[model samples]
Structure formats: structure tokens, C-alpha cells
Target: MTKTKIAATSDVSADKVLKSSANGQSVLVAKVGDQYCAIANKCPHLGLPLAKGKYENGVITCPFHGSKFELCSGKNVEWVESFAGIPLPGAAKKLMAMGKTPTDVASFTVTQEGEDLFIEA
Candidate 1:
């Protein structure tokens, strides 16, 4: 495992996901209270960047397909909730899920030394 220093503690504020890289892998780091969590930046559904998604209470929702994921555990809370918050019709949602399946996002370990945060990639 390669430990890469991504950002300072101050750079990642409470409830804000900071986009960074670890050994050429795109990563998103966030501070949930005193714990730091790192996860893949791309949404597994369609590879949409989770950095552009909405985050709340450790849950990040993909902006494109409305897939929600838990940052700390990299679990998929919901797959394809809606399209840009516009409730997708039943048939439409079913059609959209034709080729996609629910999958967990990749999570990484985070280490902190002084004010710097590092991610293991």
C-alpha cells in the first residue's frame, strides 16, 4: 500500500468532501466529526464523479443517476434514486436499471499526521 499525503486537515472541513488523488487514483476525503474517511471519487453506476454529488450525513448522492453511497463504509444506500432530483417514473427507472446493478464504492484507509491527511492507495 502506498500512503500518499493529499491535503491538510484544514482543507477538508466538516461535511465537505475534498477531491484528491492517491497514487494516481481519484479519491474523495471528508471529515466526519473527528474521523477522516476516504473513498473513490467516481460513482460505480456510470462513473460519474462523486465530487460533484451532494453529501449529507456521510451519504453522497450521485448527481447524474441519484445513486447514494455511504462514504465511511463505501456502501450503496440507494441505486438510481432519481434523475437530477426529478423523480423518475416507474418504467423509466426500470429502463435505466436495465444494464446497471447496485455495487459498493471503493473505500480507502486514511491516516493523519499532524495537520496532513494521507490515503492508502
Candidate 2:
């Protein structure tokens, strides 16, 4: 994986959000506690930048459509799984059969090197 230095520890606060550019992509960086997390800055649903969203309870809600994604996992709200069942060819049944929990979004790798936050590319 490719990594890029994005910010310093003192640059972000717990429960705060910021937008950064790395690996030719717009990344949304969030600081939760002492940990930093990164995800695509654009909302998966409509290409709106997630930097404009509100962060609360470790989740970010899109400003345009109110779509909520987990800061830690970048997964969509639980309701997305319910809604995804319709066209995925037995997706709900498969989820139940595998005893696997479904998450509606994708997560990016985040690492801290000393006091800096880096995201994988």
C-alpha cells in the first residue's frame, strides 16, 4: 500500500473532521479520541464531498442526503443493508446463512507515524 502524510496530531481534535488530498484522491480525515481514521471524501451515494457533513457519535452524516457512515469503518447506516437486499440476489439470505454482519460502506487504512496521520493508497 502507498502511504502519504496528511496531518500532525495537534492539527485535529476528537470528533472533528477535515479534508485532505492524498494519492490523487480527496480524503476525509476524522479524529476520534487519540485515533485517526480516513475515508473517501465523497459520499458514495451521490459524489458529494463528505467534508461538509456533520460528525457525531463516531459517524458522519452527509450534508446533502443525510446518509450516515461510520467513522471507524466507513460503513453506511444499518438501514442500507436492509435496502440492499432487493437487487443483490439473495443477499439477505446469504448474510444470514454466513452469520456475517453487513456493512454498507468501505474503510481505508489509517496509520500514525509518531505524531502524523497517514492514509493508505
Candidate 3:
């Protein structure tokens, strides 16, 4: 499929993120300086909305279970460390993983077209 418009560059400022979806793909556009990174808005660990999570230094931290992903490559940086910024114990964190496994978030190629941003869906 062709790349689709996600959001206007003006809508996403430096160090901020914007959520968009097209062709049934939910993506999060993060602008850091002159570069942009697009990643799936759903956390791979729990299928939660990554748009509601916190992102900083190219790392998007899931609000649930503290799963963190690197936005640029959609790589799993950390998994199930804590919830909402609180640290978790080894046993509890392991139990939370009973039926779930850690996985990296999905990422899409992004480019700027004029004042708008496009993502490959």
C-alpha cells in the first residue's frame, strides 16, 4: 500500500508525539528535532495503546507493566519491570508473564511531505 498521511509536522513539536491511524494501522509519530520516528501505537506485551504511554529519548514506555520500546526500530528495551513507574519484584513480574511474552512494538517507515507526515502502512 502507498504511504498515508499521518499528521501535520506542525501538529507534532520537537520531543513530542502524535497518534494517527490509516489502513487499519495505528501509529505513533514522534518528532525529535528535525527527524521523525513512527511506531505502532499498541504495546506488544499487552496490546495496550502505546499512544497513552510515555516516550523519551527515543524510548516509548508502556503505561502498563513498564514495557519500554525504542521508537526508531521498535525494539524491546525493557519488559515488565514495573507499572506506572513503580518498580516490581522478580516473582510478581514473572507471574504477570504467565500467559504473555515480551515482544517488540511494530514500526513503520515515515517521511515528511511538505507540512504533513506520511507513514508506510
State which candidate has the highest lDDT. 1
Best candidate per TM-score, number? 1
- The C-alpha lDDT values of all candidates are 0.87, 0.69, 0.82
Q: Model 2 misses residue 73 by how many Å?
A: 0.3
lDDT of 2: 0.69
lDDT of 3 by residue, 22-56 (tens): 78888888875568888989988778898777778
The digit string of per-residue lDDT tens for model 1 on 1-121 reads: 8879988998997777999998888899888877899899989988879998888998898988888888888999988878887878778887776678899999987889999999777
How many backbone clashes are present in model 3?
0
- TM-score against native, each model: 0.92, 0.73, 0.89
Worst 10 residues of 2 by lDDT: 79-88
Best-to-worst order by TM-score is 1, 3, 2
> Which has the higher lDDT value, candidate number 1 or candidate number 3?
1
- Enumerate residue pairs that collide in model 2: none
Model 2 has a clash total of 0
